[model samples]
Target: MATFAQDDDGVVVIIGSGAGGGTLANALAKQKIRSVVLEAGKRHSLEDIENDEWAMFKKISWLDKRQAAGGWHLTENNPTLPAWIVKGVGGSTVHWAGIALRFRDFEFRMQSINGDIAGANLLDWPVTLEEMAPWYEKAEKHMGVTGPSTGMAYHPWHNSFKVLATGAKRVGYKEILSGPMAINTEPYDERAACQQLGFCMQGCKMGAKWSTLYTDIPRAEASGYCEVRPQSMVLRIEHDAKGRANAVVYADASGTIQRQKARVVCVAGNSIESPRLLLNSASAMFPDGLANSSGQVGRNYMTHTTAGIFAVMPKPVNMHRGTTCAGVISDESYNDPSRGFVGGYRLEILALGLPFLSAFLDPTPKGWGKQFTSRMEKYNHMSGVWLCGEDLPLENNRITLHDSEKDQYGLPIPVVTKSDHPMDAAMRKHGVAATARCYEAAGATDIIELPPYPASHNMGTNRMSAKARDGVVNKWGQSHDIPNLFVSDGSQFTTSGGQNPTLTIVALALRQAEQIGRLLNERAI
Candidate 1:
């Protein structure tokens, strides 16, 4: 039995105020819709974000003694996987590298091109790229995006990006400057431009890179409609006898359980947590899960399989001078029948590391002698190209409730069961070859390919489609079964595109918020 706070006025409850939730909160506020955003982590101030690596991690990330913190799904279940996620007010966006790229038009229509591959359930998006184009532009503008558009041919590529382009040209590979990241080149929306500190992942001190904490939540609060409850761990959404969701039950920091009622519910918790919440909310009305009429709430999980290839250049490239990823290789991103693989990969150029991470990621053994110090000294000149390839959405690669393990809050732990895709091995081989060619063109000396790992940009679980039988949500991110229930996160992705999914997630959330607002307004009328 939970104590209830009788709330009369209707409020849209958004769970997990990260990239998607925060963006939707801002959009909903703009439309005069009141909202309450429930975030598991504490709100971080600008002062909390400093320059030091360890200190920055302590503040912005789920590091330190509290390893199993449940603010956001930070770790992949397997130790072999390299899924380094963050948790805080801004969620993973707090420690993001901030390389925002929209998926190409073909990405949405993947299933139409190559119908059901073996061991994969590839599906086309309910919405088209053209429908999302305006929303993408809206998200870019709202987030104070930087970089030149393909339409505006005047602005040349940045210095760091130009070098990559030059190198790619030498190797007979065409590289395009990734248009419009959610980072500012010129100060927009009162945020400063990027200072080329090469520390975007460590939480930008200059507020150049857009995070939900600094941008959306504040604006949403100012609208007098959005209220954020920090350190609030939502256990489950409670429903009435009518089968309509009425309130959210959560435990606060002090272990005090409370309930807050809302007309509508939107579970924006990441790919893993969102599915866990849905599966946990099993009532007499919804035995399987709330809004899980299709029984696909925890299926079709997609995560990127990433590999790193380091290149040692003769001239010190000064890799630690700017952003982690300034440019990418996209020549082989499309589905080509000649390649013998359905999906392709992207080569995102990155600054290798400074010292600690470099030493850890490096394949060489660090002996505690003069040889160790000598090897550590060369960490500065090391730069690498991160090869990110799409893993097909397989039903077997799913996230479910661990029947045995439980969290600190006594909730069932998230259990992830993943297996490598058949197309991955061949795709990785091509990636290694392309990486070597790119490095050779850049006048690299010793080029080494690092061990493969999960890229951590995980998606799917609660997907959108034309019908409830096909997916959990509709085209507008509304639950196909439940009219008021909604979702805004990476979990709503139907197709995991070749590029990073954050920007597209933000765009879709913004688009969904508008649609949700209209639906609410129509219902009120």
Candidate 2:
């Protein structure tokens, strides 16, 4: 509700309103600093959120023009739809499943613990897990995560979770339980308890799930220090003669160009768009891109090596009656190269509606015959799990600008290219075998291994490093080349761990806010 002048050069301008940007806005507002948030999509309230997957996805997903390349199957099955990020006021937070998790200690030091792996661009994070523990605690409490930290009870196990737990136990897996989640169990932070409507990915209409749309953004606006401008698509960042970012040019709802000056600019537009924006902002001084002195702005892209396993039970399981990701089996989520892979993965309970199952169960052109129809007929008898594993980053797996393609705004479209490392294949194969065994232990009659879906966990495009020569950002997510520029999203990840990225993104944003507040107080920007 508070508005600043277009030419006001004192307010911090944040480029997205998802977990990182939204949390950063509220954190800075709590410090009595003003900020302006420019979101590229329309603002949708709880009333506007639908419980239908296809409807809500069409309503909020970022369906902009993008191309897929490399040896990944998605390049052939879904060439134009590489990633599945949202483009609304709350960004992908509105569509997240609320599986809040922290990275393991070894995951933070991948290069050191795993040594040099072939064809992988591994690096230890500039900040370690021990240093991030306090921030993770703060983020968990702030988001009202239901776990031991908040003393909030976890949601009662649904039938599907019961099935998963039984299978996991029979398969000799120990660490089986409903992991930490951001969805409310008992009423907390003025939100209602989850109704278990089984539509979390469609957007939590009951206000039980933590989303910036109903949490951080509203809180920041209530403090009278943050102004959220939706339907404003950023074109490029403008830098002053001294190479400090000073302004941002974006297109308004009416397709009119508007410029907002800023003292600091944080790019939190997810991994793909964040890197694409920097690459599009090239100038005479920085021909490669702004803050891309190391030419790593759009390299080392990672989306968790993922696969979906669905099993057919003799009895009706009604898997789609609870949260999208009901529980997790984390016994295998540790590093053990003896398992034929450098990294590990988690088997999380997943249930997709019939519509999504039909589309993603087998994405091949000839997959719609009798075999696929038979699987759909057993919808109520199906139980599923999604394998989320650490995918090693490669220098060639990246986001690049198209040579000739352009969007409606005359900006070059982004082309996401990814190829599987041998490690990724090995981990995915191990996960499939483990998941099938668990289902078989539970008396599953048939099992099917689904290929990777459109990427939901995008990371590692503008990563952080201890030395400026290795990455684009520093320990604080501040650009190594541009002092006033920052990356407040998952794009700053040094390596993607075997966990959902929302928790770490929020934690890092809180840490970045503290550093930014200190820099502001000392007039160091």
Candidate 3:
């Protein structure tokens, strides 16, 4: 609620108030650091959250004009809307399913372990799991992650999860459970426990699932060190003669351009917009893009190789009665090239309601005949898992500023170009077949394999690296070119680990905030 001056150069300006930005704001506020959080969309409170899928999509989703290219299914099915992220105060956390998982050790060392994957731009993260464990613990505790030692029990297995685990067991898999989720199994954080409502992606009405909207942003505001400005679409980053980022120009809620001075700027605008903002910030000193000396600012885009596998069970599964991401089967979450892929995947319960299912079940022209009708009719008897796996970073798989198109604010629209690595196709084919076998063992009368939907798991555009020449940011997420500038979102990822990105994004933000606070005190940055 506190408003600072437009020329307040001491404030750290954070763009996009999602998991990373919101979490970073609160973390910095805890240490009495002032920050301005500028979100692109209007704010929505818990009271405004609706359970209806289409209604909520219109309300929260960032339906910006993002074009898709390359061979990804989304290029064909969702070209103009390549991502399904939220644009409000909490960013995509408002639309997240709360299936939090930590990055495995091998994931952090992909380049070292994989020893050079052909055509895959692999790199070891500058920070290791050993170094990140404490931060992850802090994030887990702060977010009230539901699991052992957190004083919150794991979520009880819902019908969808039950079917998943049963099928997983039948297929010789063991790592199956319904949690480590940010959703509360019991009320811990001041919020109410989940009401067993299933419209999690629509925004949690109970506030049980952790979202920065009701959690971090409010906490940051309560600390009196953070000011959240909703509907402030940042158009460019500005710098002085020395080329240090000093301010950002954005359109205010009233559609008037405003410049907010900053001592430091953190771009936490998710993967797409984060890099887009940097590319749009191109200056005479850094003509390629701000902090883009390595030409990696908008390169190496990654969305986990993903698919939705729906099965028609013999009995009513009522999958839509509980959490959307009920549980995860992480047995496949390992680095096993013997499986025809360098990295692994996780099978988590994904229960989409009728409306979501109808649109995403299949996007082909022949999608609506008997096959679709049969599946639609058996909604009550359906169980499914979202197959999310590692997506190797390729330099060509990137987000680029469109040469011609621009948004309403006169910025070049970001074009997300993605395609499958041979590994991606192999991994997905294997994952789908394995998922089908599991469902078949559990008595699936029919199975429908769905192509990847608009990616909710975007990462690796402005990635971190030990060497400045290899990436945009360092181990601390501080830009190599501009020490005071940072990337606090999933964009800082070195690799797209085989799981959800939110937990890791929060962990990195927490760690980066500490580093930022320390550097501020030391006058190092």
Candidate 4:
């Protein structure tokens, strides 16, 4: 409920109130640093959340104008929308699957582990796992993840996970467990425990899942130093004559354009929109676009290599009875180039309702037939596993501004261009085959391979680098070209590791907030 003046230049102006922005704002508030979060979507409440998947998707998913090109599997299925990001005050955290995982040591050093791979723009993270461990611990405790860091036990194996585990154990999978999840196994952070409601993709109504919508944003506002302005879509970042970003132009809730002064500006609008906003903020000094000195602002885009395997059991598995994504098979999650690829992958057990499955069963022209209907009719007998792996960054696979296409705000629409690397193909092939083996071992009558879905774990767009020539941001997510501008989101990932990204994003934001606080106290803006 706290509000800062529009002309207040002493406050930090953070764009997008999601995992990154929301966490940063709250962390900074603890240090008594004021911030104003401008979110481009409505402020949703627990009352508005529902268990209906498609209905909730309509309410929260970002359906804005975006063009997807290249061989991305979602091109044929979801051409206009390539990323399944959420738009609301809490950003995509409102729709996340509650999977919390930290990057392994080898993953943070992708360049060193996989050397000189052709067509791969690999780089070691300027910050290492050793440096991030404490931050990761803090994030886990803060989010109440089911882990020892939080003094909580992991979630019990759900039916879908049980089905997958039955076959996985028989197939020699060792590292199998109900992995760390952000959902509360027991009520720890004032949030209620999960009641085994199936539609986790739909926003959690029980508040068991960690979401900035009900956690960080409210706590930051309660501190009386932060204000969240919903439906404020930023158009451009304006820099002073000294080339320091000092303000942003945005359309308010009523469609009125307004300028908000800032001491610092942080962009956390996910990957695609974050780069698009920076690219749209071109000025005479930054003609190539703001903070694009290395031409890396929108380059090196990566969405984790992903796919799925659905198995039809002879008996009713009743997969859709518990949390959607709690089981993980991480036997392959290591630096094993011997597996026909450089990086590694993990097989995560997940279940979807019939509605979502039918749409993604086969997204071709002749997708629906009696055969498809027959498979869907036995929903209770089906169990699925999602395959995800490290997607090596490719400089040409990027987000670009369309020359002629414009949205309701008249800003050029973003075009996402992607082509799978050879490594990506090898990883996907191995992952799919390994996952199918698990189901086939578990007495699966039939198996179906599903192509990659839209980009959910998007990363590496405005990536971090040790030097200014290589990327847009530095170790602290500060813009290399503009000192006061920062990217506080997954877009600052130097490389995409084989894990869910939300936990890492939150940890990085918490770490960045400490640095920003020290700099603010030293008057180093």
Candidate 5:
């Protein structure tokens, strides 16, 4: 057995250091609380970021050559769906395109507007959008957002907002700047302003994007109260005979086993790995999983279904020269009762992708040689929008233990069980016409919608609610079954919002961190 480190007094163990964990670490540090963050991936530097898409697709993610065999795998039970989450210090935020859109007020009350689907367990959020607004504003200010506050873009702080507004208005639709993003356009919080490099998806080497490593984590570390341990993958939450989490078991880079004690454990390992960790921590008290009294540890998995629609314009748009989603057409965010679907979608204009990826969105004429070449030469000025719709939460869609597969640390791998409910498909169908309308309004020539891909925005496994029977965590994201254990990640969401869930996740983490800090100061934990 590897030697264990001396446990620090009043130490809070935080798993995963993405937006949630990083933000909470900083918040707790402000209250003079010490935290130890355990991250599965190593810290990547600016040197790791390259210009090539192929290198980015491989390097930015955790699909290193040696571990590629044991990397995340999709299943036939889940059908065509695939898992695309990154594992690292900043997690998938490193590769994200950085389009931050706040969910409309309607998203907090999905069940109230329309009854639940037959197979789905859709419900309203424990907290409303109003409760989250201040935190959203806090997150915006912390990240130094720059955008316009109008139609699609609702915040006027960013300089790019006006430029996009003009583009949207030329097509007859009132263009509004999107909500505050986590990018630095004018240099705030000691970070430099964005140069509009348009390589965010490949990783922002300039540190213009507000990733946790560059923002929250740095602040927390600077306070001298937080210790970030990278490349340490936790195997399980070690519980005492009384069923209370006392320490975490993990392996080092050399495959040496180690343990570290903690008074409180906060897990922020996203939707996929959070559930996997809990299920692996099963003991006599939690035979199924730790803090799984509701038997809902890994159920109700949801991801937004997205299809990219690219259009070829007549002018030299220079589409790939800026942010991925510079302009959006979200006239469809609110749920229209007449649409025949329970949910609605948002349409945001996307900058053109790389040539190989763009080919997937190309609508070339049948036949081959000459015809394909002719079409490609004509439509190179491609610009487009991504249509994202909500998928209802179904109990059958879950993340369970794989029969034989295990990770390097002898932990059972996550087996995802998923299928799009008919209502979900219908919602996507309902939004198609509206997507075409927006492109037509923008003078798109030869529009083509790409096939649906695995949504990176996954959430709602350990859902939060008012009662233990209806959810796993309470309104504060504290485990009802285990008072000292908390989950402050996307897995705690009761309803996956209509738009991008990153901003809300950040807001929720901040709110929960404050509450936890107060409770810890009073010795509640």
Candidate 6:
């Protein structure tokens, strides 16, 4: 692995090594640009991945102390853990289920299509889908997505998908199939095919999933232009007198504060921490926060309006015998205000292990009664679907620093406050109804409508806009206030599109890498 000195002022310092930061580091390395990636978790090898859900979760999840507020049920249900992000070198990519998807055309221009929806912070992305098409293709190829675009075979349908597809067809749905997934269907990219272990969210033990821990990060190191430093938690980004980002201060693994000088800094610490880092970096020049001139740095936070629906089949379905979220039904994933919702959502096949089922079955205090035990007993006959919907951005739904609470590093902990827009509730109701009808059509005995679980798709905090006053970053994800600063994560999303954000996050990182590289060559920063 490559190593760089702390005072390497020419190196680009990127915080977090997730889908965006990890991909950006490798992309920059490909352009012969040096970067130092700071990951705030312990490094783990393929041998460390486990097939057990709870075990792997304990091993990789970002178990940091965070608070949740506002009207979102998570405050009461999961107050301390509102988001389900990972820590380690690969970030949440290590725990992702590899469902790669792209946003629809109208999704990029939500405000244009919806036309001034009240109480919603609808804004069109500075970059269009047409502009991102090539990047999306590159991302698909790089991730080895199993789809027609890559000429890669999709995984064989497991019994869980069969049940979901059967129900979907019965309910008059057409686009029901195992959708584009980053998990390999056959040997490709020097990675093995998925071993049908059914614990994809836990981490792929067979190296079949496209995680930066085994892919882009190593490739970047091999290029000898990128250095990934794990167990380094960035505390703040520092800028010069002219307001250009110059260095990052982080705590090393030994709890020693170290400063790494840089020409450019990219923050990709997931949506929550990404903005928290900026807010914590407030200074005399940018008193509110770095690059927070518009006061939008931590506003418009979104996690896909989501819900889980599990149905008990008359016969044994054994939904947990295969991949976690490979099956998808996209018939409803289009804009149609006639459905009482401005945006749309997709119903993807989902399965949880017994442990998670027991917990998420009911998050209430007295949720472990006979009813819960009875539901666990019917686990073998259960089939489930997760609703991935577009969560409308509200200016008030944001991440703010806690009043007094501090973390291990003494930085104020972030309080994620979110509330469901009326549209969100309408869309979720529509999804639950449609999903229940599908299950009923397939002769399901009973159905369980699970509330939103800990957020898996975190997006939209430091979003992009054509005008600097409208957002924190520009189309290239460069900070409007700090020329040398950038947001290389899902936090740069203009709107929460109805798709798994990993693909778009990688595409944006790839695109940003090119822009940053060009700027470096031109000495624009």
TM-score of each candidate structure, all chains considered together: 0.90, 0.99, 0.99, 0.99, 0.89, 0.99
Worst 10 residues of 2 by lDDT: 155-164
Model 4 per-residue lDDT tens digits across residues 1-525: 689888999989999999999999999999999999999999999999988878998999999989998887666667898998998999989988899999999999999877878888889889999999999999999998887899888889988898899999999999998879999888878998887898776688998999999999999999999999999999999999999988989999999998999999999999999999999999899998988999998998999989978999999988888988989999999989988788888899888888888878777776788988888897899999988799999999999999999999999999999989998999999998998899999999999888877788899999999989999999999999998999999999999999999999999999999999999989898
The residue ranges of model 6 lying beyond 4 angstroms of the native Cα positions read none
Tens digits of lDDT, candidate 3, 1-525: 788999999999999999899999999999999999999999999999988999999999998899999999888778899998987889999999898899999999999988988888899999999999998888899888988548788888898888878888999998988888999888877988888999987699999999999999998998889999999999999999998899999999999999999999999999999999999988888889899989998888999998899999999999989988978988899999999888899988899999989998988667888867887999999999899999999999999999999889889899999999999999999889888988998999998899998988999999999999999999999999898899999999999999899999999999999999999999986
Off by over 4 Å in 4: none
Q: Compared to the true structure, candidate 2 yields what TM-score?
A: 0.99
Candidate achieving higher lDDT, 2 or 4:
2
* Over 4 Å off, model 5: 1-6, 64-81, 147-175, 355-379
Q: What's the TM for model 6?
A: 0.99
- What C-alpha root-mean-square deviation, in Å, does candidate 4 show against the real structure? 0.8
The whole-model lDDT of each prediction reads: 0.73, 0.93, 0.91, 0.91, 0.71, 0.93
lDDT of 4 at 336: 92
Pull out the clashing pairs in model 3: 18-90
lDDT of 6 by residue, 1-525 (tens): 789999989999999999999999999999999999999999899899877778888999999899999998899999999999999999988988799999999999999998988899899999999999999999999999999767889889999889889988997999987969999988989999887889898678888989989999999999999999999999999999998999999999999999999999999999999999999999999999999999998999999989999999999998889888989999999999999988889998999998889889888786777988888899999999999999999999999999999999999999999999999999999999999999998999999989898998999999999999999999999999888999999999999999999999999999999999999999998
Local accuracy of candidate 1 as per-residue lDDT tens digits, 1-525? 111233833888888888888988888888888888888778987888877766775565543121222211224222322344566677767867676777788788878988888878778889998999998887767776664442322123444445556667888887556444566676778888677777777678888888998989888888787888888888998888878888888878787887888898988878877888988888889999888998889788777656777766666666667766766778988877567667667888766446534444543343357644554565655667777776677776677887776777788877666565767667777888888887677776767676643335768889888867878899988888777888789888887877788888889998888788788868931
Predicted structure 4: lDDT: 0.91
